[model samples]
Target: MLKRKISDYLESYFTPNRREALLITGARQVGKSYAIREFGKSHYSSFIEINLLEDSIARTSISKASNSKDLLLRITAIASQPLIKGKTLIFFDEVQVVPEIVTAIKFLVEEGSYQYVLSGSLLGIGLKRISSMPVGYLTVKEMYPLNLEEFYRACGISDNIFSVLEEAFKAEREIDSIIHRKLMELFRLYLIVGGMPAVVQTYLDTNDIKKVVNKQREILSMYVEDISQYDINNKLYIKDIFNLIPAELNNPNKRFILKNLNENTKFSRLENSFIWIREAGVAIGVYNIEEPKLPLELAKLRNLFKLFSNDVGLLACQYADGIQLRILNNDIDINYGSIYENAVAEELYSHGLKLYYFNSKKQGELDFVIKLDDKILPIEVKSGKNYLRHNALKNVIENKDYEIEKAYVLYNENIKRVGNIVYLPIYLMMFIKNREIENLIWKIDLSSLPQ
Candidate 1:
């Protein structure tokens, strides 16, 4: 099985002496359950699995049991499996169906019998309904769709190559053209298949883009179904917003405008719908920051924001009918800037960065703004090879008012540095993190390049 970065964290969570019950939450079919199960089977002497959504008796047992010990007894009875204190792993999948099970986690951790791992889709919605949170007891982790690095691993890329790329990235040296082209090819595939485990696996197994997009559509349908089922009061509004993302992103500014949806529609009226979609993990919001400065969240204009699908492939699938094929064949004539921008957003978000953008009325709009140490870095995404003419980025960096030291322009180009701005290929986004940005500098060895 292809390893996920979260797997290492999960392993550490189950180390020799661990206490807190684990709660894994993310969108549906992002491999939360699969990761937990894989970890359990390999790490534990015995593993007991229960699906609260499918097993009513298990749900009833969990809800009715007065205490942790009683709950264990009920589980033992249902599974007819012995619960070894330290060697057993009890996994509860789809716990959102019975959120009472989540509340019971406090007592379960207190019991200190078997190690527990709970995973559920739409967990954020369930969490709102939770009476008492397992504040001090549960260890929570949010899983996202497979990132580029993980996707590379799934494609059986070598670690040595990745290490080489990392080294080049740190030195800000352009890689060999051949290697760069190869990675770009892989990145194009990633844009189509996305980071969803199932979709990626389907692509790997069949090498069929048609099958891959079919799976993506299925997942999109599931997201719509979730909206309909979970937010019944505003299902239409939520679906409308969801369906409008592709068009919204394709706009010049890419800011989500409620007026576009409906001239009379105010952000306040559909705030819950936005909240529901975000909480469900189907979409992410990038708020507009009026000023670019440290503590980017403070200057955020909540009403002014852009909405990106959690996965780029989904966004691509929604861009137009048969658009994925057009993208793959390079046959489409329209600008695909939104798809590339969405992919960058997903990469940044998966790295634990909050999304924010800066737009100056005088300077123009920058794609994203991220905080690195005490410096505010402005990132601009360009679809084509037009890496120059970054008026917005140049303005932000040059403006003494902002005092920005460095800026980034992600595009389809080899790595290079021009003054304070760094140009990186979009695929290299997976290598960027807040801690490492300080070491990332342009140090081109011109002598090494072929003349």
Candidate 2:
């Protein structure tokens, strides 16, 4: 398996003197189970893994125990190990199948001395079933589809075009046209193929777009299967919402409006079903930012929201018809503004920031608004060349309602700063990791801060 950045997150979660049981939540086939095992092999002396799907007996055994110690003993016996506390890492894979396993995790944390990491794609929806439990005993680490930088890394292209691109970003300089042209081509392919682990690995091995699309379809099929089985209560509605995705993208607004489903459908009828998709990590909810300032959640208009599918490659497949890989062959600027912006939003989300859209109603809209250190930074994405359209950023600056430090426009090339804003290549959004960006921010002098 390709190494993931989340490995470091797992290492820290398990190593801390003040460690807590962890809940790893993400969409299915996103490498959650594989990651847990990889992490265990690297960090723990002994690892106990239980797949709730394969071993129904294991689920029954863990569920029957009343206390943490008994449950630990039960898990150890199922894995055929002694119940050695504090030395072994216990992982519950496909944990959503048995909700009681979640409660049991909390019990173990409070009453026993073992480290634990529980994970499932369906785990987010499963959270709603909890009435009460040891809430403070667990921490959550949410994962998303791979970002562009990670995609290149996984493909083993990090040494050449990837490293060159990273240097351009670190220095905030434009890339050479030749390299830029080549990298942009890869970036566009990534948009169409996406960052799903299975899809990418298949493409890497076969160099086949058809195989990649097939893999994407398999993932989509699983969501459909889940709606029919686990989400049976809302089956028809889930199917209805899933079918709306293609049309939703074609809409200029791209927000999920119930009327968009069918002329006769009402918004009230699909509210919980929408929540179900977001909770299941099948869709991401990008709320409208009423104001670009602190307390971004305050700006949310519950009824007006933009939804990005869990995978960009899947979205591309939905938008494009057969025999048109030619579009990706040309350039990023030709036909990928909305799709690239959605991919950028996913990248930002992986950095642990909630995605919000800047809508002025009268003025133009910014692509994303990210909150960091209680400050809202408006991020506008463009596949166009470095031509600054700072009207939206200007509006925020002139209003003075929110102290706008600086705005970012993610374009196809790097740009010089003008006034209180900086233009950046959207590629950097995928290439630069959060820690590296955080370090960049630390090195910025207030004296040279954008005015």
* Candidates in order: C-alpha RMSD to true structure: 8.3, 6.1
Clashing residue pairs in candidate 2 (N, C-alpha, C atoms within 3 angstroms): none
lDDT of 2 by residue, 189-294 (tens): 7887888888888988998888888888898888888888778788898888877775675566677777756689766777888888888888888988777777
Q: Candidate 1 on 403-425: residue-level lDDT in tens?
A: 88888888887999999999888
- Model 1 residue 33 lDDT score: 88
How close to the true structure is residue 417 of candidate 1, measured as C-alpha lDDT? 96
lDDT of 2 at 41: 66
Q: lDDT of all predictions, in order shown? A: 0.87, 0.76
- Output the lDDT of residue 24, model 1: 92
lDDT of 1 at 35: 89
